[model samples]
Target chain A: MTGGYMGRILFVNLSTGEIREEVLEENICRDFIGGYGIGARIIYDRQAAGVDPLGPDNTLGLITGPLTGTPATTGTRYQAVGKSPLTGGWGDANSGGFFGPYLKFAGYDAVFFNGIAEKPVYLFVDNGKAELRDASHIWGKDTYETEDTLKAELGRGVEIACIGPASEKLSLISGIITRRGAAAARSGLGAVMGSKKLKAVAVRGNQKVPVADKERADRLRSEQIAEMRTPVAGGQSFIERFHKYGTSSGAHRSALSGDTPVKNWGGIGVVDFPEPDSLGGDNAIANLAGRAGCWRCPIACEGRLKEGTGEYRYPAGTRRVEYETQASFGTMCLNNNIESVNMANHICNSYGLDTISAGCTIAFAIECYENGLITRADTDGIEMTWGNHQAIVAMTEKLAKREGFGDVLADGVKVAAGKIGRGAEQYAVHIGGQELGMHDPKLISPRRPSQPSAARYQADATPGRHTQGFGPSGFRGHFLNAAGLCMMGQMAADPTKYLVGFMSAVTGWECTMDELLKAGERIANMRHVFNLREGINPIEWQVHPRITGNPPQEEGPLAGVTADIKAQVYWNLGALDWDMITAKPSRRKLLELGLDDIARELWP
Target chain B: MTSRGSCGLKPDSHRLNTSWYEGSRRGQEWKYCPMFRCVVGVFGLPREVTELREVEIELEDGARLRDIIAALRREIPALEGDIICAGEDRLTDNYAFNINGRFYQDENELQVRPGDRVALLLLASGG
Candidate 1:
C-alpha cells in the first residue's frame, strides 16, 4: 500500500447475512484513485444492466478517497453510489462530516452492500469488526432522533449516516443525513438504503489513517491552509468569508444576477421577488448561533442558525440553510422570508429530502394551481399561491409522510408532472428526472453559437446537478472530488497546483496536473459507460425548454438569451471525445484511458 | 494669464461644468471641466477596514467603470490587486460589481454617473 488508504473493501450481503473482506487491488486504486471513481467502477463491474434501481439486485457502495482522513484540507468526504431510483441511471451523491473519517479510521476503504434484509437493521463497524444489529426501535424516527438514540446506545463518539422518515417511506428525493447536518442529498440513493431495510451505518474507530510521509503531508497541508488565508484577487479571502457567513453569503447578489432560479425557473428575479437581499448571506449570518466544520476542514463554512421564537421556531442547533436550500425555498417559491427558508431547511434535513427537488416540486404545484389545472381541492384545501410559506411548510410535511397530494409529488417532479397530466409537464423545470439547481444556464456565456456550458453540465448522465463541474473552469471539481477536497476550499486556494503537491505527498506517486485531470476524465468516461450500458443516451435525453430559454425571458438580465442545447451538447461531446450521434465514448478514447474492456463492451 | 472663455464659477466649485481658475499653475490652457461624482460601497471587507465600507469618488466626465475602479483602488490601497485588477482593467472573478441593481459583466464599457450606486460585492459559488 502506498499510503492514505485502508486497503480493505468490506462486502456485506444483507439477504443472507454474509460478510466478507477483500483486499483492494493496487492497480484499481492507482487508476480510479478513490471515492466516486472507485465506487462507480465497482458498481459497473458487479451490477447487471437494466435492474430495478430499488430492487434487491442493485448494490449500494459507500466510498472514501485517498486524501480522506489524511490531514488534507476538507478531506472529510464520502460518496454514496448506486443505481438512482430517481434518474434510473448511474447515481452518486457526496457528503462531508465525521462519518467518512471514522469509516477510514475503521480500516476500510469502502463498504459494498447487496441483497435485501428481512428486517430493519443497522451496520455497526467498531474498529474494523462489523456486525448487523436490529434497528426496529429506530426505524420510523427522523434522522436527528435516530442519531441521538443511536449515540445513546452505541456511545457518543460513534459517527452515523442515517435516513429519516422520508427515506424509510421510500420518497424518491430522500437523502442520507450525516453528522453536523451534512447530507448526501441527491439521486434518491437514501431510498435505495431504505429498500434494503438498512437504517444507518454507525462507525467508531481509533486506528490512524496511514500516510506515506508524515513530514511531507504536514508541509503540504500547512502550505494549502496558509494560501487559503491570503486573499486572492477578491478583497475577502474565501476562508474568512466562509468562517463568517458561509455559502449563503452570495444569495442576495445571485438573485439579482440571474444565478438563482425564481418561481420554478419561470419568473424574472427582480419582478417575481423584490428585495431579495433579505434572503442573502447577511441575514443568514445575523441568525447564526455558531459555526461547524467537516473533519479536517478549517474554513468551517457550515453555519448554525438560532431557533426562532414563534411560528418559524425550529431547534436552535440546526445547521444554517445553504445557498441551494435558500434559493429553492426562498426565490423558487416567490417567498423572500429567510425564516421560512430556515425552517424549510430544518424540515428537509430532519426528513432527509432533497431540498432542490422538493422546492421545485412545490413550485410546480403552485404553478399548476395558478393555471387552473389543479384547484384547492387538489391541494387538500390549502391555497397553492406564490409565496405562501404556510402552504410550502404544510406540503413539505405531507410530502415527507406521503400523505394526500404529497404522494403525487413523493416520486419527484418528473413523475409528479406525468400524473398531474394537463400541461403540468411544462411547469416542471428539470433535466432528465432530476430538478434543476439554482444556477441559470442563461447567465453563462456560450463559448460558441448560443451554447452555454452550464446547460451541458446539467445535461450529463446525472442530470440537473450544478456541481457536475463542466464549466470553462469547472474541470477542477473532478480532481478535487477525487482527492476528497471541498469545492469551496478549491475555490479559495487554487487546487490545480496544491492538489498535485498533496497527491504526491500522500500517494508518493509524483502526481501532475495533467495526470490528475486525465484520471478525472477517465472516471467521468467510466461513469458514462455505466449509464450507456444501462441504456441512458445523453443525446436523446430532454433538456427542459425553460432551461434552454425556449420562449426566452421577456425581461431581466437574461432576456432573449437561449441556451442552444443541441450545439452545446455537440461541443461537449467533441470536447470529451464522445460520438455526437451515439453519445458514447469513442472506443479509441476509452482505450487510451486504459478502459480497454469497457471500450470492447461498448463497441462489440 | 489668458482669461479665455472663463465661466463665472470658482475652481473649487462642485458644479458639473465649473470653468478653470489659476491657469498659470500649468502650461496647458483650462476650459470647462466636467466632473462625475458617485458613491461606491465596498462590502465584505475585513473588520479592520469595515468603516471604509462606502466612499465617494469624483472622476472626469465620460469616465468608464475602469477609471472609477482605478480611483477606488488608489484611495483604498488594500483593495488594489484584490477585487480590482492591478492594472484596473477588470474585476477579478472573485468579485462582482453591481450598478443600480444590475450586474455588469463587462466593466470596461460601463459608464458611471453622479447618482449611481455602484456596489463592490464578493463573488461566492455554491457548496
Candidate 2:
C-alpha cells in the first residue's frame, strides 16, 4: 500500500441513510494519484451521461492528495469534484486550509456524498468514526457563524468545510468555505452540496500520514526551505515577497500591463484605472492584522485584514482580498474604493460565494444599467453605476441573500444575460457559464504564435479557468493539485530541484520526471474525457468578442491587440492529439498514456 | 560639456522624462547626459521593492538586451541581484524580457535600438 493514503473511503447516501466504508485500492491510488485525478476517474466510471448536476444521481467527492498532510511544503490543498452546476461539464475546485489534512487524519482518503438527506444534516468524522448529525439549527447561518456554532458544539480543534446562506439558497455562483474564508470557490459545487441537504463536514483526527522515506522527505523539505530562504536573482526571495504581499502585490502591475481585465474586459487598465498603486502591495498589507498559512506552509501568503472603520464596515480578521477579488471588484467595475472592495470580500466570504463570479456579475449589471437595459428601479433603488462603491457593496450583499435584482445575478453573468435578454448577452463576458479569471488573454504577445497562457483559457476542460491546461506545464499542475501541493508552494521554490524528489520520497514510488509527466498527462486526459462523454464540444465554445479584441480597442496598453483564440485552440488540440471538431482524445494518445479502458470507451 | 549633447537634448532642459527621473531619484535634480536612452517599463515587481516603476536607461550605441539589464542592475540597487543574476545576462525561468512587444524567454542576442521600450517583466505563471 502507498504510504500517504489512509486506505479507506466513505460512501454516504443521504437519501437512504446508507453509510458504507470501502477499502481504497492501491491500484487506483497509483494509476490516478489523488485529489481530482482520482475523482475524475471515479466520476467518469460511476456517473451516467447527462446526470442532472444538482440531482441525487450526481456524486460529489471531497478528495485530498497523498502529500496533503505530510511534511511537504504547502501540502495543504483538497479538491471538490462533481458535475458542475455552473459549466454543466467536468467540474473541480481546490482550496487550502486545515480541512484537507484533517479529513485525511479522520481516517479517510476521500468522502463521496450522494442523494439528498430527508432533513438538513452535517457529517462528523472524529478519529476513525463517522456519522451524520442534524444540522437544522445552523442551516441558515453564514459561514463564520456556522463555524463558530459547530466549533462550540464539536470542539475547538475540529476543522470544517461547509456551505453558507448563499449555498443553502442554492446560488449557482456559491461555493464552500473553510476556516473563516479559504474557499473552494469555483464550479458551483456549493449548490451541489446544498442540493443534497448537507451543510458541513467537520473532521478531527490524530493519525500521522506515513511517509515511505521520512529521512529523504525531511532532507528534501529542508533543502527546499533553504532554497526559498536564499534570495532569487532579485535580492528578495520569492517566498519573502509572497509572505509579505500575497497576490495583492501583482494587482497594480497586472492592471498597468493589460494582464488584468478592467471595466469588465471592455475598458483598458491604465486609461480606466490610472491610480492602481493604492490597490497594490503596500496598501494590500496596510490593514494586515496577521498572516495565515495552510497546514505547515512556510510561505504564509494569505492575510487577515484589520477591522473596518469607514462607511463599509466589516468585522476584523476577514480574509484579505486576493488579486482576483481586487480586479473583479476594483478595475472590472471601475470601483477603486479599497474599503468597499474589502467589504465585498467580507460579504462573499461570509455567504460562501465565488467573488470572481459575484464581482463580474456586478460589472455586468453596471454595464446593463448604463445602457438603459435596466434602471435604478430594477436594482431596488441603488444606482448600478460604474465606480459606485456603495452601490457595489449593497448589490453584493443583496446577491448573497438572493434578494430582488440579486436573484437575477446570483447565478452569474451567463444566467443573468439569459434572463435579461434584450441584447444583454452582448455585454456578458464569459466562456460558457463560468466567468473568466481576472487575467486578460489579449495581453498575450503576438510574437509567440502558440502562447499556452492565452489558449489555456478556452481549451482547458473547464473552460474559462486560468489555472488549467498549459500543454506540458499544465500536466505538472494537474499532478501537483492531485498531490495536494499548493501552487504557491511550487512557485516559491525551484520545483525542478525538489518537486519530483519530494513526491518520490513521500509515495515510495521511483517517480522519475518522465513517469510524473505521463501521470499528469493521463490525469489531464481523464478530465477531458469526462467532458467529452457529457457531449461538450470544445470547438463550439464561444469566447466574447470583447475578450478576443474582435474590433480592437482604441486605447490603453492592450490597444489593437486581438487574440487569435481559434488558431491557438486548434494548436492546443493538435498538441493534445484530440480531434479538433469532436474534442475527443485520439485512441492512440489515450493508450500511450495507459488509459486503455478510456481509449476503448471513446474509440468504441 | 556641451549643453546640447550628442542625442540633441539640453543638459538641464526640461525634457521631463518622468518615468526614469521620478522613480530612481525621487527628489534630487539631475541632468540628462546620455547620448542614447531607452524607456524601460518594470512590470510584476512591486513599487516599494523596485523603487522605480519605469525608468529610461542610458546605454552605449550598439547596446543589446543584456546591456540594458546590466545598466538597470547598476542603477536600481533593489533590482541589482533580483530580476537578473549578477554578472549573467541570462534570465531564469521566473522572468522574461519583453522589448517592443516581443518576448524573449532566454534569448540574449536581441539588439536594443535607441529609444526602444524594454520591459523587465515576470513570466505569467502560478496564481
Candidate 3:
C-alpha cells in the first residue's frame, strides 16, 4: 500500500493467548478504504451469524484509516466495530484522540480480538511489538484511573482506550473512554470488551505513516488549510466557531429551534424550557480553564472546565460537556443547571457510560415515577423527580455501580421498561433497545417519506444513532470516517472535492467521488446485512411515538410536525437499493460493490 | 461633508457620531460629529469572509441591523448578500444573529445603532 495504510492487521485470540499478523490485501484496501469499512468487512466475514454479542464468538475490532497518523487536520480517530448487545445487530463507534494515530504508528492498520480471556488483561503494543499484560490491579478502576495507572506503568506518551465500571458490570449503554472525554460512546461496544475480559489497549509508536507523494500531500494539505480559513456564504467560518465554542455554541439556538428534544421527547422546547441560554456555549466558555485538542488538530474544540469552589465544582481537566450531553442532562431531565450537567458528564466519562442512554434511561425512570408506575420502593429510596439534579447525579452513580433500580436501568430503557411492567414501557423512548440521541425528528420536516430521515437512521440496523447515514452529507461523513478525518473537518470544505485530493495524494490512487460514495454505501449495507443475518427485520423495528408526533403538541416550534416513519423507511429502502418488503440489500446492488459472496449467501 | 453635532458626554452616556447627509453619493466620506455607532460582532462568519471577526461602523439616524450589514457587505465585498439578504429581510439558516443578546431569525425591521452589539452565530456541523 503506497499512501495511507500500514498494510497489516493484528489478529489476537485471547482464549488461547495467540497473536498473528495478517497482511491487509491491496484490493481490499482499494475497495474498502479503512476505518469502518475495513472493520465492517472483517466482522461480516469472520463472525458467525447470531453469535451472542457479549459472548466470545463475537469479534471486536479496533482499526484506524490511512490518513490517521498523517499531518492531516482532525485525522486522529479510530473506529470500534462488533455485534451490538443493545441493537443485536451491526455496531460501530468512532472517537477522536491520540489513539488512532498512535495505533497506526505502532505498525498496524487494525487489531481484532477473538475469544474470552481467563482473566482480566490489557493489550500493550509498543512500536511493532505486541503482548497481553495482566490487568488484575486495574480491573475494577474507572477509565480515568485506569488510563493514569497504565500511563504510569508504561510511559506517559502511550495512548490508551479503556472501559470503566459500567462496562465491567455489563451495562448495555457502556462505551470505551479515550483521552478523558473522547468516547466511542454509542452501541455498547464496551460490554463486548468486558465479555472478552479485556480492560484496555495501550499503544506507543514512533514510525511515520508512509505518504505516497510528499510534494502532492504537502500541496493538498496547504490548500485545504487555506480553504478552511476562508469564510463561507453566511458571515461565519465553521473552523473559527468550532475553535471558539465547539458544538456548544449552538445549544441555546438549537433548543430554541426545536432541535434539542426537551423533556424526554415528550415536551416542547418553549413550553417545557424557555430559558435555555443558561446552558449554552457562552456560559460553558465562561467556566473554561483551557482547551484540549486531538493529535495535530488546530481547531481545539475540547474545553477544559475550571474547578469550582462549591458543590457543583468540576475538576480543572474535565472536558466541557457537549451539546448532546448538555441537552440530555439539562433540558431532557428538566434541569437547567449547566454545572450539574457538567458534573453528570464527568460521571459518565469516569464511569464509561453513554451519556445519551444514561440520561434517557433516568428520564424514563422519572416519567415512570411521575405516572405512579414505580415509587421510591422501586427507586432504591431515591425520589426520581424531574429537575432533581441531586437525584439525577445519585441515579447515575447507581447505574454505573448496577445497584438497586440502577441495575434495571443499566440494560437500557426498553429492557428496563419490560422489567417494570405496569405500562412502564410507554415511558421508554428508544428504538430497538437503544436510547435516541437528543435530535428531534419532528423539529425538522422530512423532505421525503423515506428521504434519509432521522427516524430512519434511528431504526437502521445500528439503531438510535444520530450519526448513521442520513443523506449526501451523511454519506460523506462515513467516507471521512473511513479516511480517519473528523466530521468537524468536513464542515470547512466539501469532502467530495477536498478529501478526494487528500486521498489520491496520500494513497497514490486516483479516487473519484462516485467511488467514495459507493464505498460508504457498501459499508452501510454490509452492516445492514450483518443485522439481517442475525434475524433483524429492519422494517419491523419501531420508531418511538414521541419522536413521530403521535400525540402532537398543542404549542411549540414543532407544533404539528410528525415524522411519517412508514413512508420514510420505504423511501430509505428504495434509495439504498434494499428490498422494501424484507429490508435487505438487493443482490444486484451487492454485486455492484464487489460483494458477490455476500450477495450469493444473502439471496441464496 | 459638514459636521452636524459634537458634544463629549459622560462615560455612561457616551455615543458615536455620524455626519452623512441624506442622499449622499456612494463612497462619499462622512464626518463623525456626535451620534451613535453600532458594533457588529462577527464571531462566527463562514469561511468565505476570511479572518474578520469584528467590525465597527457609524450608524445612520434610523439605521437598522440590515443597514449595518449592507455597509459591511460594501466594505468586505465578499460578504455581499451572502450573510444578510440583499433586501435585509432574512438571514440564511446557516447563520444566527443576536441583537443586544436576543436571537432573531428575521430582523429586517429591528433597529440598531452604535454601542449596540450584533453577534453573528454559526450553526454548521460538528461537536
Candidate whose TM-score is highest? 2
> Among all windows of ten consecutive residues in candidate 1 chain A, which has the lowest summed lDDT?
A444-453
Once fitted onto the true fold, the runs of candidate 2 whose alpha carbons sit more than 4 angstroms away are A445-451, B1-126
Q: Candidate 1 lDDT, tens digit per residue, A1-604?
A: 8788888999999999988999989888888888888888898998899999888999998899999988777888888999999999988888888888899898888899999999999999989899999999999999999999999999967999999989999999999999636899889998999999999999989988888777988887888889778874446666897888778876656665566778888887756774677887688767788888898698888888777766888898888888888888888888888888888888889988888888888888888988898998988998989999988888878888899999999878899989999988988877768887788775543113333445554656588887775422334566677667776667656555678877888888888888888888878887778998988887777777787778877654455556666766677778888887888888888989899999888899
True contacts kept of 3: 0.11
Q: Name every residue pair that clashes in candidate 2.
A: A233-B81, A233-B82, A234-B82, A235-B82
- Candidate 3, TM-score vs. the true structure? 0.84
lDDT of 2 by residue, B15-91 (tens): 43332332235556664433467766565552335655566655545667776666555556566455667666556
Per-prediction DockQ scores? 0.12, 0.15, 0.07
- Would candidate 2 be rated incorrect, acceptable, medium or high by CAPRI criteria? incorrect
Candidate maximizing DockQ: 2
* Tens digit of per-residue lDDT, candidate 3, span A65-106: 888978666788999999999988888888998999999888
Predictions in order: lDDT:
0.78, 0.82, 0.77
Docking class of 3: incorrect
lDDT of 1: 0.78
Write down the TM-score of model 1's second chain.
0.68
Error of 2 at B95 (Å): 6.4
